[model samples]
Target: MKSTLKKLLPFAVVGVISGATTVGVQQYFGHTSNNEDGSYFTTSKNVSFAGMNTSAVGDDFVAAAKTTVPAVVTIKNYQTKTSSRASEQDMFDFFFGDPTGRNQRQRQQQAPDNMPSGLGSGVIISPDGYIISNNHVVAGASKLEVVLSNKKSYIATLVGTDPNTDISLLKIEEKGLPYLNFANSDNLEVGQWVLAVGNPLGLNSTVTAGIISAKGRGIGILGGQGKAANPIESFIQTDAAINPGNSGGALVNVNGDLIGINSAISSTNGYYQGYGFAVPANLARKIVEDIKKFGIVQRGFLGVSSLDLSDDRQVAAYNAEKKTNLKVGSGIYVTSVTDDSGAQNAGIRTGDIITKIDNIAITDFADLSMSVGSKRPGDKVVVTYLRNGKENTSTVTLKDQKGGTSTRSKADLSVTEKIGSDFDPLSERIKTDYGLNSGVVAKNVTEGSEIAKIGIVDGYIVLEINGKPVNSQKDIERILDKYQGNVQVKFVDDYGRIYTKGFKMP
Candidate 1:
């Protein structure tokens, strides 16, 4: 009886050990499933799952891209052909070289029946369909189409364009569209992560990421008529791989906030070669707001031309001329002031080296420009400058591009004091030499006249009425008398150069 009991105990112990080993293996492999009471276990060979630990970098970037890409859009523009003269074709041929020198034959042949087409990128700025893009993208375009990531295309209307800043605003008819909010570009620090979203090379909704390479970099690319000199070129440089078609796209922070508009690139091959430039969203916002309010950007200018402090010789000469003991290592040296610019009005002289604006240190011309541009016309700002080794502060009211105190009045002679037109007519020799048939010569300018107030001097010859040739004083008087309100006059100086000035007649 004892041997039988021992044999049963050994068998029972072996069965219990084998069952425990099976349960351990099933638990480690996650193949065992249990009920709430822990009394039942089940396993299915066909059901399988696996997972791995991932990093937050991938998830955060992916989420940012998803949020930003939808607000980035592809802008397609079409400029209508107004003439079939083949002037553009001839110009193209002159540089590109005609395969067959039959330039005459090509010119005689009918020009392409279609309009010129171009593509770029834009950022949706408002949910009600206001989009912002570079002016060059939609300038002179007869038709503009904006396409979103959701495959919805909307025709956009050009609200306004500021060529000085290369910013243009457009409005789409659709409402409640996805848009991106702007970040304070002034707060962006070097080395912050940024993402560039655009239609690079027509590749729609492409995003490239990199850190901010620099801030306040001036590339000297933008310039044209009535366009102020490239004053505000404090671009935020990045390595975000902005390509040709990426112009007007958004350069966003990692949190999906728009900080800048991707503008130009330092490239030799016309493609991304690492260096890229963007207009700060702060400046862009000001320009966009100005263009939206007025048909053009109403920018405030100090009206003083300045040279970089890097030009030591010029700095020294300026110091000597102005009799100032300013150390020539920093700050902008004012070279000349326009006759009636804000600086001139504020008694800011040519020799004054602007050292600070609103307590912010002015390191160079770019700094001054950015500071001034940040404010609208009529906004008063404090300018601290060094003159004759003495620091002086002035509270100067900003003026618009047309040399006016504010942008409220659009009258041609709003800011100018109109001088009475009591002047001797231009002589025949002076007319022949100046290449004008006839016109009235500005002999005496009164102090209260708009011309005198804005710095137009006596002795300037009126050359054209509207744009037509004015051969006599009768012609000038006739044009002015006929146009009772505001009129634009094209006049030639004694040296024969022509300039256009607008004035309101009494």
Candidate 2:
């Protein structure tokens, strides 16, 4: 019995030694294999990591790519150029670069019938060939063509466009198309996997994957750029490698749901630099629906010009000047309130700090813009604000730019409404001073209008439309009565620079 006990003790000692050696080796190497949560610990810094090895969790993007790629399509914009408008082409090239990217001067030096085209991308949103794309992508296009993933091409008709949101809706004559369903963008959280499907750089049906880096990002790419009047810019930021042609493409999640549309990129050289911005799916979907129903965006106006409180420098400056202890990142500081507007009627005055809309916190202009911009005129929103260090709430009814609470359909709009601008015949003295053959003065260029999106201002002088001299509003109505598709306008800016621009007829 003593000999058996001695032999068992030796085996126990051997087992203990082996266990100790294994533990010591593991500690020294800092390797942990039992971490089933896709995490690991290494000896390099005794640090733990997660989501570094995505293969462990099975990131099979094949299903997502298959579902998204078919819904994405390539868009081609064709424009006919005339030799007489070479200088005008230069202006267009300066504002919007030639999509073909060949030598503009060389192309301009070609025949008067030169047909230069641009390339972009689009996404089908309905099974009946209803598509959505960036307004800039199809803007000024004489002809738009959509190419499906299977190489089928079809001429597309422009349904409508909202420049404030940079969203455009187009319809092709086809049935049973692959489309993407809109997901609730408000549910999108940062760091979630997403895929960008588009025709980037003319690459057909290109797909790239990344994560949602941010939400409700306002980067001044939209109305903040001073081009779009009342720009709605609550963008969803992602690192999804969006490039030039990716504009108007689909930004979808792994479940193949559309959350946003790739719109702009943050880059120093006009290329992807790991930062991309998209129009949030919610805002975009609203714009498209409005356009489809009303033939225009039924945009609601909050009726106040304010400064973003999130801008530290601006907030500091305001607080110092106003002698108010305003907190940074609290909300927007109202600088001025529009007269006869809903905000003024609701007792919202200058110096009021708007904090929220409809119970949604307004951390910055982006939040406020999204909350209110999504609603149509006559929509009521509960506005929360701070005045004199006291919190207050008001249910405010939104109004249109004309200070009206009623909605207007396309048929209800007149010729001037369709043109989005009122005009007065140019005075003889003004025309003589400018040495113009025929001219008219543009007035009240409506915000978010097709002409406004083309950079036309309220005080610009209109010389021609469709190459015919426009001397009065009646002349414009006459010419546009028979005009179709792209309408060319020759105008002179305040500085007397003659520029010809094109915009699609609404």
Candidate 3:
């Protein structure tokens, strides 16, 4: 019986092996076994042992790159030469040489007629051809060109620029281009992952990844000769390896949403040295929208300068000034409120400790500036402060640089005159040569007129009246006569530019 069982086992094993081999071959050849009723069984022959293991990471980065790279663009700027100055070498040769030879050299040394060229990067902010970049990129540029990811280049026009923030807006003629949507920078965490996308070192559409190193960082990086002076320096610092060409690029989050504009880097060698900074997207969006609507940023001012309470002496002074339960180092101490400022108009006095703006608690000047900067000129905010050892709150209506209320009504210049004796008309040669019809040439200004109050200086030319062309003083008078009430006068200078200003007719 044992010998018979062993022989049967061998036969069974052979039958099982042969059946397995036949099944494998059938599956490979796309043949599935079916029941006698002709119902087929489904099977797959190429099942991966490590199934879906590489899809999450390998596919995610490729997908993000494909989505974001297309929105990044390269910006090229050109400046036209107005007048040429002699080169230093030529001037030295002429000044130190013999009189006859110097005159001949001066005659031979003529300035080049070509303009200087510059390059930078810009990010498309909207689908309708709006772009945001650094002001330094397109400053004094005569021509601006933007190159899209598809290698298509288009001429761009300068929409507006804010030197205080180092931000500039540009518009391309083509519409419906790929763009990035802004994410709320206020929601960003300190260690959140981010990507810096730009034309770094002229390598177009380059991307580098890092985490947000810090927030609300005040590094005096943008302060230098010939740079736009910025009073506020709160910046979002990252370790994304930004370089020269990364200015005006997009600093996006992991979800491919833009959270900031890559603006500057901290380096001595003029290259990436790990520390890069970006202007928060919230600020960028506000400035861009304001520029689009108002042609300039309507900055809100608190009208008071304050000292941070973090300083021991300042904290002691504030504590001594007001006997309260407040800690030694708590909030920003108001040092002085300028007369006629918004704060003064709102009855904010000196020695008041600002504890909160709106609902966010303020710890220092940066917090106050960031909060105020986030608001428009007319927006009113509740300021919580400590006065005389007692907590108080007040609703302060913000004001623009010009001392005005929280409305868009035409500024009152009723007490002013149209053209003072100080008004100097443009010369006939300048008017005829520049193809002028009517305009106002500014001369000496008074101390308290509307023009002087708004900082319009001598030599400024009024170029248009009520949106109509005004090339000379005669045109301004005619338009003022035609529209006797409030009129919008556009001003231009010796250079061909325009500024829209409002004034009431006398």
Candidate 4:
């Protein structure tokens, strides 16, 4: 019995040694796996490090906060107010009648009997004082005041703005500014850490951290309240705490590179409720370049209306409607193709399922919109679609809204399109009544058009635009083509009275 016990004791000692070696090896590998570059990291709690490595290595967001917060600035939009009262809430501020004391203070500060002004945020993108922000932040502002992180204020001039993407570019008369560098948002994976740096609730340089909950999110929030008529919404969704004043702020990756611009939040109370949406940096960068160079967005259109196949119920409905679908449903199901669109030119039919673009999978409508929206007209893209479960690829050359593949110069853009007015040639009867041989009639005035603000109504005859005759549509287009700054429009009202109003080009 003594000999047997001795042999068993030796075996037990060997077992203990083996267990100790195994534990040491696990600890070493676990600690080595800790990422230092901050590209991506897994939760330490979920990883069993033999209970030895317990520190939170990937949870600290200080490095990202420090890198991004300095590039974000506060924007004050100063615009004309029809009503001279302090009752209205500031734009990008708290909701109207917000009970918070902070909100009340902001209302008192911004709503003081003066021009209707609001405060928001912007991110400096260039060292020469080129800042990019949401168009709503500076839209309709006669003057824009930008306050940097150092509290230095500059009266910025509008470079250009695109309402479709809700992106605006402002330039200050300064150079060598600290700016946020752009990162490719197309490579951003779900669950990657992202830090939002902005001025939420008027608090400047507020930094919040969260994971990329989703990509290619379309919430239909932009162009709301009749701001942008045709809104392009392809948002990067995150769990970041983005509130008012966070718009145009930088959403940086773990490496402190700009991935997105915080644009809106999904909440019933007009505040952040765990869901914040941002404009992808890729698209925003393109819009900014277009606005700065061409004074207009050169958007590429795929020209196909389609539905996403994310939900099982929607897939089932689509299948029921088609009456021919067998099973596997993913990507977008093309419903219709626009006439003379890039899709039509590429021979993309209604029954084709768009699966990929340039090697990137199209999971939803937002993905397709962004894929085409990211490029300018005249740019080409490779589209891969599945027809009857057979894969096919087409290299599609995208076209502009005018169905042209050439870049539109500033002079080619029409004033009627910009001012939102439908001008028609003056009829013989109206011409005779107005005592004018050649004039154009404002057939229909858009509700939110700048021409509408001039008090010009439908049936009013435009006698002269910018001191030029309005005898034909070509005349009007030629006069206002790429025309910037103030344009004096003289017209005879329906009451046979002459009215002249000076409207600054937006």
Candidate 5:
């Protein structure tokens, strides 16, 4: 009995030591949420809010402003101007020579040198120089420049842009720079004190304070008229005095943690009237990581078109037309489900009311949109809905826009595959008439392809592919061969307007 007791004592001691080690490690590392949408981080470190007590005793913002101001940068966009006057025959003859009388072809108009088009702000979110800015700030830019608060400047490389979310990722060749850390926006409450830091009206390093006015707002400012398709707007509204140059600025909490990216303002004069909107940090963080990893956002679609229950007029009309007693502000009414979509696969049918996504209640469309927008394809979500006044839950496996359940890399598609069009060598007549050295004509452009999506039609002349001259199909293939990222194509549309559009490989 004494020998058995001695042996058990050693085992008990070992078990105690092991348990102590686990508790210590957990205390240091903290409890991280394993969300279905994955995590957001700048480095390998887990996201933490250890000291982020929003209910703390002070309203002082000096420390918060000081911590965040140095990280915001002013972004300048330089774009090449295509003169419309060069397109008309009279103006063309005035600029060059007349084409009818002379057998010689008119000289092609030279594009004007790139000029500074606009200015915005950006937030450095990493010590290694990763920046988050609005996509509209960098869209159509031939060159981008970033100026730090210290008056130092660097030529910025656009890693990727998602116009859907109006978020862009940029990089500068620098190290050990000051940057802001992301905070979970889901933890933010209404009336919380926050700060907006940016350069406004050419004013550098300006900071303003305000409270969170609202959340889950969709203002319809993003999509339409040849802009971003399928725009996602779930903004954190604040009265933070955001201005023209504050478009891509930082919206931080009183603790100096980044909670949102300053994006749009609700104003009639284009200046701050009272309220401004910001893209939430959780969504922005997801976009930044996606752009850094895949060169494109891995957006997951729920595959159902629904009406927002918050709109009383629309809901009333829907209820009356459908002869149902659906109440306003209840949930989203599913009108149609896309074929072969995750919702359809999950057995969600028309007339069903979507009540919840995971644990979040869907009172508005923006709530559901933001919940799904932050997730990537192949991520599973537990969806709760109501069918005929009965609640049901389904585990849905989300899919990409292409209906694939797998993750995609930019290298997955070749240039031709991305363009989805065939190329043929330009005719001798076209070459001589346009005074072109080399060119190829787009042919058999497939519908729903990137080329067609960008409004490129059949017979559009391609002068350059990624800044390299392309005279034949082989030329395009060679230039874009193994190119695993964004490709810029210089095209001469039917109106002779030169357009330099960008597209991703996948």
Candidate 6:
């Protein structure tokens, strides 16, 4: 009996030592959560919330979920296309296989009926029904429907959209709705606990918790053809299990304040691969505010072609291109300052190393982009740079893409504002010479305007709208006010050039 008792004592001591070591490691990493009786349990090691209490990170996942889930909503985008019957050539090619057997030419004529509905998520930003969402989610959408956590639904209108930041503003008629306020994403630190609230994969009111894996991360996605035209991507990287349909949802801190908006994920198989990206709240808030106050976004451009020094490969390429032996380092390198742009106008020369903006350190191109992208045109920024190893400073006012320091606000203008154009009456003498009774002249061609995209410039006189005569600016408005997707605009320019352009309304 003594021999058996001694053997059991050794086994018990081993068990006790193993348990003690596990608890010590857990406490150090701050994965402790509270139970009902106030005892703590360790579940993870990545989250840490120091300064909140003498205790380790609080496991307040339930509190954040309850605060945010009600404001996150599912958005359904309904789009329709006119079905086109096969042409004789298409029919012949279908019956008898194409010569290349690839159907490349036939693919170009694809006009299908009832494109599949696209789904995403949105975060309500105000009790008066202003919601912030992803531009890609609702862009080109003919109809938008939002469903809340309580199962109540509402029809939403597109207040304004900015593809550059991939942020869109929407409004519903309802008042006193649940909303989440913005937190300073610039203040968010790495390893801080955060929660992602959204309807991912059609799972409504889902909340996932993780740590802020990184900040000022640029994934090299967005900003191209068929995507954001002038993409601003300085993503807050996390591992919060965001999936499809989480694009426009909220990424909140432990205090339930919005730190970011879940934008995209880094994966090879189209699923979470431990890397998810969010648009920082600071930049998103700027975009939402601009869209709300102005009819369009008031983006500020620094106007300098730069090399992202954060990337070693980009550094090597830049060195090779310019034949300079500069070392790869943090912050943005000014390769060339665009002529007459904000940078050049402010005397920012080539070969300058931009170190700070408004006193905030420019750690990388992402930092610079986010800092400048958040400001509007005509806003002044203090730029600190290194020239020949000496630090110098300059005050530069930002410019719009058109090189103009101006702001755009919505007027009680024609509905054609959706098409990004303003229409005015043509002069009677010119109209008589053109043998026209009345005509609406398109003016103020925005950079990305639909009419401008179809090769029509400002001063083009509109003669027809969808085959109906457009005698006045209101005529063009009345014809397009009810049209959802695209309409045909036939016009004549000042150079006596007659052309028909297709304008798509956003």
TM-score of each: 0.66, 0.76, 0.62, 0.71, 0.70, 0.69
Task: For candidate 3, write residues 80-119 as lDDT tens digits.
Answer: 3431111111212222333343222122222223322445
Q: Candidate 5 has what TM-score?
A: 0.70
How many residue pairs collide in each prediction? 8, 0, 6, 0, 0, 0
On a 0 to 100 scale, what is the lDDT of residue 186 in model 5? 97
Given candidate 2, what's the lDDT at residue 496?
A: 84
Better of 1 and 2 by TM-score: 2
Question: What is the Cα-based lDDT of residue 118 in candidate 1?
Answer: 55
> Compared with the true structure, what per-residue lDDT tens digits does model 4 show for residues 79-117?
544311121232222222233433321121323334335
C-alpha local distance difference test of each model? 0.66, 0.75, 0.63, 0.71, 0.74, 0.71
lDDT of 6 by residue, 1-506 (tens): 00001111111101000001111333422332233443332377656545565233445777788889999988876543421111112222322334554432223223223332456789999999899988766644556788888989888998877767778888888988999999988799999889998876556788888889999886655542223445677899998888667878999987899999887776543346678898899999988887777777788999999987878998888788879887878888998888889999889998899999999999887788888988888999999999999999999999987688888675532476567667787788877888887678776644334554454445667888888987777887788776677788787755566777675665
Candidate 2 global CA lDDT score: 0.75
Say which candidate scores most in lDDT: 2
Report the alpha-carbon TM-score of model 3 versus the true structure: 0.62
Candidate 5 Cα outliers beyond 4 Å, as residue runs: 1-59, 83-115, 316-327, 414-506
Q: Is candidate 3 or candidate 6 better by lDDT?
A: 6
Candidate 4, position 232, lDDT: 74
TM-score of 6: 0.69
Q: Candidates 1 and 2: which is better by lDDT? A: 2
Best to worst by TM-score, what's the order? Answer: 2, 4, 5, 6, 1, 3
After superposing candidate 2, which stretches have Cα over 4 Å from the reference? 1-53, 56-60, 83-116, 316-327, 422-432, 435-439, 443-460, 463-506
* Model 4, residue pairs in steric clash: none
Per-residue alpha-carbon lDDT of model 1 for 129-218, expressed as tens digits? 889988656643557788898889888887866555667789998878889998999899998878999876556899888889999876
Model 1 TM-score, 2 decimals:
0.66
Best by TM-score: 2
Clashing pairs in 1: 416-450, 417-449, 417-450, 418-449, 418-450, 419-449, 438-471, 438-472
Q: Which residue pairs show backbone clashes in model 5? A: none
Q: Which ten residues in a row have the lowest lDDT in candidate 3?
A: 10-19
